[model samples]
Target: MSRLLSSLRDGKGFDIVLVAVPLAFLLVFSGLPLIYNVVMSFQAVDMFSLGTFNRPWVGFKNYVDVFSLPATWPIMRNTVIFVVCSIAGQFVIGFALALFFARGFPGSSYIRGLFLASWVMPGLVVGAMWNWILAGDFGVLNYALRSLGIISENIFWASNPAWSLWAVIVANIWLGISFNMILLSVGLAAIPRDLYEAAALDGANGLQKFWTITLPMMRSTIGAVISLGLIFTLQQFDLFASITSGGPANSSNVAQYWAWEMSFRQYDFAKGATISVVMIAVVMIASVIYVRSTRHEVRG
Candidate 1:
């Protein structure tokens, strides 16, 4: 016992203990719940059988049923649109801002730090704030657009079926921009200044330097950023709940929000679980990409 204690205090035993604790925690909390969810997806689950794990198994019927619904394809389409647009907008704007601030201008650090405020705020809070800005009659956005002659009238951002999804997408892009900027800024900073100087001496213009030096070096970072953005965007539910509620005839419904609506509002637990399982598969793919990207970065 004394030897065991000694090993734990100052040997590989300590490292084993460090790993074991978190492993145990994950198995209990994350792993078990994930297994349960998958099992539920295959079983016949409803409000009545929700309390027990002894429900009848239905195989892939839930998945078929979920897809057979008229709303499924449209919601999936919205999800695709939301994910693509949000990621593109956030990454482009964030990359631009990262390059701008990477110049290390006066007060740049302070200004960059302030941008993190958007990322730190809760999704619900951000949605509520954007709600006011997107209001049709007295919205700040409409006023600005009108003042700029971009539009002659107020736009009902959250209500109109045409604009509802876009309203949520815009808010999501705003929420994610700071996070993308910070990660991209780190990547930019890691690039050796000597490379740029060498390129400049060789008659490389700014555009040439960016294409030749900056992009190749940032490959891993970009991959990781886009994969993570997919995971986050797929899991985005709070913004839907607070901003659109998947409303206006389900024009803005996405997979995550639809899953919640099925589980709680519609009391279709099996279908909800099936939807979640599908999303889990997509997120797992993104996770693999993220892992590969980070591993490549570490090797570099």
Candidate 2:
């Protein structure tokens, strides 16, 4: 049995070699960081003790403090709002854009290119551009609105806590459509033209065709898009942080930003690690449900 096992390992040597570089990287970085964070979460270490060779062990205290935070519920709520609004809005806008492009009208290729450009742009760059566009004193958005007599004065833009959250949401919506449009375009392309022809012959209008044929036929694609979007949004940090830095008054604080603040800004590594662990658990639980529901095969 030992010899057989050794032979089996030898048989997989090439596969192991193929993944050796990535496996080594994951070990040195991802695995080590994850293990270290988990360990940190169980210990009690202050900023002064950060470099000390000796660290105190205080099981679950970090976690307890994490859950005990006054901002925890609000931050979690903001995270939910950010995830749901960003993903759902992006999905709808992307689907609509995909449908419009599918018509193959004039300049459709250019429009697709525009969507691709947004997708390719870095999130931080997008956020920085938005900060200018939404700037209070000299924002193009408020300028145009004022010129059109939509309002007498420029709004606070991102100054107010409530409005700042929406500002971030708006920025999210703008960038999010790219993912949906790109994915849905392929799904739209994969759909057979004959189905549309048959539906047209049956006196079905475009809306009817889309509802009865396009949507159902593209369920798997839609599921895949939603799943990826959910995963990305759940851990989203860059745009949110760059846009508001967790906000004018902490109103826009999401779980990601909170974790960053705890770990980096507050210099509380143990509590930060605890928050990271909790965030991982939440994401994993949600992803499990999402993956199970979106499974391709469901027949009993």
Candidate 3:
């Protein structure tokens, strides 16, 4: 029995300890908050009333309010549209940029800092910078557009509801391309050159090689990058909040900003919790599909 204990406490036990740390954090922070939020969503949590101790038990009334409100549908619809368009745009743009970066350039190392600098900047800062660039009157973009005969002298980028969504989407796409480029670049680098060479010998041109060899080889990496990007973009708040404040007449309001409005601006904790819960469910559903499709390995 003592000899058995000694062996258990060596290599196997060391691995066990390593796994335990993340598990402990997941339970304390991620797991507990998820459970608590679910509970809170079901209750009548008043921002102002009996402190945290005594609140009425309201089962799904908050959810009902969330569903029934006229404003809610628009926000939700907007979120869906934003998420879909942004995801599609990012996939296309990022994939192209990744391919570009994979072909090493004379100054690719220096250029990476220039291209990915926007991504590494704080979200709020990115929002502010993009806001200025996309602004109607004095924006550099407008100036260039006018100079190049794209739009007259004055064009409302965020003013029209039709264009406002696209404007925000463009920003999100720009932000997304960097990470995707970085990951796909790494994936491309990790590929055994022999595979490409063999494909070339077998009459596979550049297009054929990419479709058959590069994409299939990088499937897991691409999946992880795209899925995580969707999650982050779906929960986007800082950019919308900072640049538009869900504004130009609620046109830019996403699920996260709507929840922010409920909790922080409107001082309605119950509604906020309700929105938070729903948003969480949306993210989790995406995550589930991602996991199922990608077969992501569960890391201990």
TM-score of each: 0.96, 0.87, 0.86
Q: On residues 1-300, what C-alpha lDDT tens digit does candidate 1 reach at each position?
A: 888788987885888788899999999999998998898999998898899776999999999999999999999999999999999999999999999999998999999999999999999999999999999998899999999999998999999999999999999999999999999999999999999999999999999999999999999999999999999999998899998999899999999999999999988898999999999999999999999999999999
TM-score of model number 2 = 0.87
For all predictions, the C-alpha RMSD in Å is: 1.6, 3.6, 3.7
On a 0 to 100 scale, what is the lDDT of residue 241 in model 3? 73
- Which pairs clash in model 2? none
| Backbone steric clashes in candidate 2, count | 0
Better of 1 and 3 by lDDT: 1
**Tens-digit lDDT track for model 2 on 1-300?**
676567657895556566878999999998898888888889886688777847889998888888888988888888889889988999999999999999998999897888877777888998899899988899988999999999898876677786888888888888879889988898899888999999999999988998999989888778778877877777778777777888786788888778889878998888888888887877677677567645762420
TM-score of 1: 0.96
Q: Which candidate number has the best lDDT?
A: 1
> lDDT of each model, Cα atoms only?
0.95, 0.83, 0.81
Lowest summed lDDT window (length 10), candidate 3: 291-300
User: Which of the two, 1 or 2, has more TM-score?
Assistant: 1
Better model by TM-score: candidate 2 vs candidate 3? 2
Model 3 scores what on Cα lDDT? 0.81
lDDT of 3 at 185: 79
Task: List model 3 lDDT by residue over 61-160, tens digit each.
Answer: 9899889999988988889888988888887787888788778889886786577887788888888888898888888889998899988667677777
